[model samples]
Target chain A: MSKHRLLAMFKGFDDSLPVLRDIKAGGCAGVSIDDVDYLSPIEHPDIDEILERKVNVQKFTFTGAVFGVTFGFFFLASAQASFLVQPQGGKAVVPFPTNFVLMYEMLIFFGIWTTVFSFLFLAGLLRKRGTLYSEKLTVDQCGIMLEVDEHKLKSVKEYFKKQKSIEIREEAVT
Target chain B: MEIKDKIIDENLGWQRINEDVIRSMDAPGKYYWITFAVCIAMVLCAVAAEIYQYRMGMGTVGLNNPHMWDMYIATFVFWIGMSHAGTLLSAILHIIHAQWRKPIYRFAEAMTTFSLMTAGFFPMIHLGRVWNLYWVLPYVSDRGIWPNFRSPLVWDAFAISTYLSASALFLVIGMIPDMAILRDHAKGWRRKAYGILALGWRGDDRQWRVFRKTYMLMACFLIPLAVSVHSIVSSDFAMSIMPGWHVTTFPPYFVAGALYSGCAAIMTLFIILRYFFRMEEYMTLNIMEKTCKLTFAIAMVWSYLNIIEFASTWYGHNTYDKELLINKANGPYAHIFWLMLFCGSVAPFALAFQKLRRHMPTMFAVSLILQLGMFVERWMIVAPTLSMAHNPHQWDVLYGSIIEWAIVFGSFGWFSLLFLVFVKLFPSVSMYEVKELTFHLKHEMEEEKEAAATSSKSKAGAVGKPGLEGA
Candidate 1:
């Protein structure tokens, strides 16, 4: 089946939101919007509704932190316990208070690494580049890319037109 | 015009901000090369000094038995303390949603990362056999020898490394969106460099949502981590059984002093960047004024702690503590002590006046003085306490060698060099956050105007009614 993708650009968030909503409603009428993605120079409040889609990045962060704490404790304790304990000044081999410091540091270190890993995973960063990208999206312009049926192309273009899209481009997907 | 409206006018739009920031990276002027060359030269000099010290041993650098922790450790503390204000300011201000932080937080966070890098060097240099530095790492080895987790030095390693990693991550993550922006605008090798660094950021809502969440998580982690890192550094001295070093108030005292010095360093760099980058509109007087005010407040906190330290020492009636406190004021290092007081405590008072805060040259001079005072303050904290320890027989007055001074100067050049490279590469001012602030201000102004228009129309309608006008 052939697909039509419509890309619209706007000057700012305020200019873009109404157009985005109109396109969503218009897609519901006929084209059945397959996917919608926004590209902008900066984050916007209007983007929140789209971003609220469930993401599991924070779960990995929590798991990494817990592992960090447990591993930090075990590493510090085992190193001290297994070593040739000189028993300095009658101090315990694996002191708790001092070891807590290392534990705290490890928690943060592992937590941060895991967070970055999760970010990479969930955000699909460092992946094979996608074709639908515009350099202007990084500057003053905001872009909305929509996937729809080829048969509904005329109506979708008219829908974006009614919303007064600053610019539009249509591409055919195989 | 209202202050907010004026700020909007000065900053303009996303396009203008991008142009202003990216222009700095476009070409290397003669001044840029000159500054870069000077930093390289300073770094080379420091490398030579380190080589000399390595060859001759620890004795070559004014480190006697009593003053073993002289300039290197002092400078380490200073840098560590200097690292504090950036993360503290950036994280805390961000958490609180301070709009002014939008313009300065990028460099401030960069300062935290680079200063920590410089700080990491001192412990390595202070080691007798720097090659054996890996022994500090916690791992099971064939020899079964492990680092004592209980040692504050080990804690120092952990704290500094953790702080460095987190700050560096924070700095890099913060730069990603900006890097994506650079990737779009750049050409040739620069474009490839930014593209790789940007990690295919398309500024999609999903990527941004995750990025913001991760950034916020890091900020939350950074604040407590930053505070704890310095507190751990303080424990390096305070955990010692030494008289002056064993104060109960050391943690808060050290934290306050770190913030004080760090804020001063920020002001010093803020003005320099503003002047050099021609970021007058973004790095406006309003931000500097707020910075000065914060510095003054921190100075006051540090001073109050300083007084409490003295008072507690005197009142506790421990001969060694009292003697050390007295010696700090009037003994061998008296000049250094008083200089610290003058610079750290007294000079910040000038900032309390709005006029001084607004004047760039005066504020810069004051910041420099405050940093100098802070540098001396670190030295004072270490040297005097160790020199005038309980054993008078071991007491000796020692000065930092020329080699030590060279290394100290080198650290400054190293930090500046990194920062200069950063400015040349990335947007030193956060392009997106600044644009966000401008947008909010513009929106607010429109709202206010609309409200005024509606209110005025209602007033006009009321005035048209005879009973209302008479009443």
Candidate 2:
């Protein structure tokens, strides 16, 4: 009984083409690669790098500016809110100075919110399709594999005989 | 044969474990019974205190105007702060790839759940008429007025509920497989209990797929909840107009303090679990040391904020803010103020050194001290400022009466008592994650050596053994 069962673990990838090549070579046996898993780590070294690489630096800064502007708006609104009552103030009653504290907080809060969410989104956690591979990949091993015609089995086996930890098996349908 | 030569050694070769290390159920001879009786008695005491508080109204707990939320608020904040250590250690550490955090995380999460339960009681009980507490929420009201969305109290309610739900979900999702493992290993009632909790989890591919997805989603959800919960708590104070209470920095500052105190509380519990549950093998020096580093860093942040807030008050020339700062530092409560600095600042800062951090007993002591100091910090925030208000004529000295003190003591007693019972009920260390980490670490180490050896062997040989080499 022979059914293609192959496991490959690669260290680094220069491009998705090599991975795509490996997957094509495997021909749908059982392909698992941690390349996407390590993408965040491999791409951004730290928080600063995360901010820099995604071209979100300007966006993140702009959000901070917007946060300050909104805080000012809230400050004026709340202050002017009291002005609507009896004994209307002669001049503006907005607490601009005290409101700066709120502005600072909103900026930091939004900063952390953006950074944390972006990390999750970048990791492909936001829109995960059915995982690219199966559950056994987590525990046993990870690789790309091909389920080929019985006639091609011997050739495929021979091809990967040189690589480390390569195995092939097949089974006929009942 | 001569008598000396004929004599055989008959020593039992027993290892000496710290008395604190032994589980309450498994205490050495008489101490076992002693610890069990004590823990049971403490649990009983807490239940009795709760009953008394319920029957006589919360006034029995010495809560009154000006000091409306004294010991309970302090304790609630303390317990909630303590809960942070577990989730932070679990989810954040998981994201950051710290293998050592796994063993400590399971119990720490349990601590979080129980402490949250205990923390929850305060808000309910603090509402003197606990029966009417449901009105605190928004419902299709007969009064036609929804609970004020603007009120920080409502936000606190929403935040705490969300946090508890999320934490419970997080803890349950993480524990399901482990519970299944327990189901397999257990017998009778334990087996049935674990089996139910396991929810027919059989480690199948489909089950794993869902489990992994749910776990990832929960973690993503929890990270924000963790930040949001503390921020909401801070909002309760910041929303107020009291000089010391109103500040934008409270949210982040409170979160930092919560994390700082939470880390220390976790350390205390971690060290206790390590010793008491015979978990030194699983918990280990590496885990404690990593926690020590986090606690030290967070403590520095907390101290920096404390100074900055004081500096801002002094610099801004806000008369009320300046007076509150002065009263906090040098007025009637100066002793606790300095003690807070000593425990939260100086003691933990010593952990900056690697050697001191590695010393288990020292780390344990420092952690306990910092947790106590955090309790005092919450007290200093709530009590002294109210006692020394802007309207000097209305200022009154607030002292915690005996009943208030009892509730505080009884809550700690409740926490410890619950913790001890949990240790007896379940394995405190996460067996699966720990085993997985150990396997990964060993495999990684072996892979390094094998890579070196393979390079050398490749020149001399043609084939390599594959299956077990990597496994």
Candidate 3:
């Protein structure tokens, strides 16, 4: 069956929170709250509760940092070993202290690139399908969009209206 | 509900902030175009001079055996130092949750990215054969030779490239949400441009969560990276066998000087941006005052380091170092050295007075003079030491030729042009961060009022009690 999507806009973050809470509560009453998304000009504190359910990018960051440290040391050590055994003056062939500088820099370099990679990967950036968005959401308004059953659409719209949503947009989703 | 409504409503509304900042991206006044044209002319002149120098060889710009590293290297260091204030200031302030940084950090970070780009050109220019510059990279070649891992120069290549990539990413990541704001408001070509740059930023909670985490992680990474980048640059001189250059204190000394000059540059740009963009409301007098205070503190730190460097040289009694120090004070460069003292050491004291700090014209002039001092300071570090090195027979005064002067002028113009284009393309002031600041301020005020009401209510209840002795 084709589903309906409802997008409700509110003037303030505080006003939007109650609507989001009610939408979550509505799911317990047999209404399919298939997905809920909150949009705002600035990140709102209440959004943290919803974010707990999303994929964590920090794990990727950890993995990247580990790889960076390991690769940094390995690259320097191997470079030293690859050169001819002609010791410059009385110094050691592999100067560990001096090599640490490049290794340190590489650690930061790899760590940053991996963090960026993970963000792009998990955030689903450069995706083919665009998200449901409203221009006003980037300005003074806050938005809540939900995919719900058609029978529950009227109740959802009424609930949002009662909660003082400034604008409500509805569209059919196949 | 009333409390929520009152707390949510702020003086600088989201719509107003958007309109004020995004207006600069619209058709700027005729003056902007004129300034832009002048910058382009300067840049072209610089490019012409570079081509001339390239054809005539390194001899066109005044380099000799003893004094091999001259104005190009000095200017390179100056620009690298100038780049430090932006990322260091933004990252450090953001980490500490300094709300005042919201309006200025965007431009400051842009400065970091552009100055690094400008600084990157110098080593190539100094290389004479700029074409073979990629030899510094550590790639395995058919010759089976690898870049020496022990060389500080190699360390510099790694540090600078890493910093450039990291800061550039940091800059872009911070701008995504703001770009999304512009994408929504813009039309035609602007819409397409911002839409692509915005990376489909939809302001979803999930995306923001990851963004904030990533941004914080980068900031944490950047603080150390910024410090290390300058330290490695300083190592270029410190690790050398030259007497005056081989000082243990050079790293910290260079870092302090870099921050000092960088802060001054930021003040210079801050005032100019305020005047041009009508951003007086955002870049208010109070913010300028705080910035001046920070600059003054850094100036004092740099001056302290300078004294320590001089004192240590005089006390250590190393013949080459002492000779260089004496020559710096009483040699042909004496006038420039004294001028550096006055500009770097004395002028920043003017900021100590509130009247002078708040006076835009006075502060602007002081910033320019301070930067002059810094430029000369870099020159002094290079020329005097090389001129009065261990072998007295080779000592001779080296000066920059006309080509060097043109390139210096062009570098300033190039930096300005990049900044101008950036301001036009992106919202120079961060839109969302500023809104966040406004919200926090409003919330704080509401909380204070509620606390006061609660205290008064309890006091009234106690006063009405019959058991009160005063009653």
Lowest summed lDDT across 10 adjacent residues in model 3 chain B is found at B1-10
lDDT (C-alpha) at residue A99 in model 2: 45
Q: Write the per-residue lDDT of candidate 1 for residues B446-468, one digit (tens) a residue.
A: 89899999999998999889998
Residues B1-471, candidate 2, lDDT per residue (tens digit)? 222221111121111111222233342356545766776676566667767777887666556656676767777787788787777567787776766676688888888888888898777756767877888663425655445444667667766776776676667667765665566555788889977776654442223433444455456546766787787788777888888888767887888888988888788887876675566566667667777888888999999998887787889788998888888889888888899989888888779988888788888888889988899998888888777877887676666755566666767767777776777666576555654554455545568789989898984554365554445
Instruction: Judge candidate 1 against the unseen true structure and give its global Cα lDDT, from 0 to 1.
Output: 0.86
Candidate 3 at residue A164, lDDT? 92
TM-score (all chains, Cα) for each model = 0.96, 0.69, 0.95
Ranking by TM-score: 1, 3, 2
Return whichever of 1 and 2 wins on TM-score.
1
Q: Is the docking of candidate 3 incorrect, acceptable, medium or high quality?
A: medium
**Which residue pairs clash in candidate 1?**
none
Q: Model 2 over residues A50-136: C-alpha lDDT tens digits?
A: 122232333443564476459646743553455444343464445454344334444434443443344333323324232223322
Root-mean-square deviation of every model: 2.0, 11.7, 3.1
Candidate 2 residue A81 Cα shift, in angstroms, is: 19
What is residue A146's positional error in candidate 3, in angstroms? 1.8
User: For residue B471, what is the lDDT in candidate 1?
Assistant: 82
Which of the two, 1 or 2, has more DockQ? 1
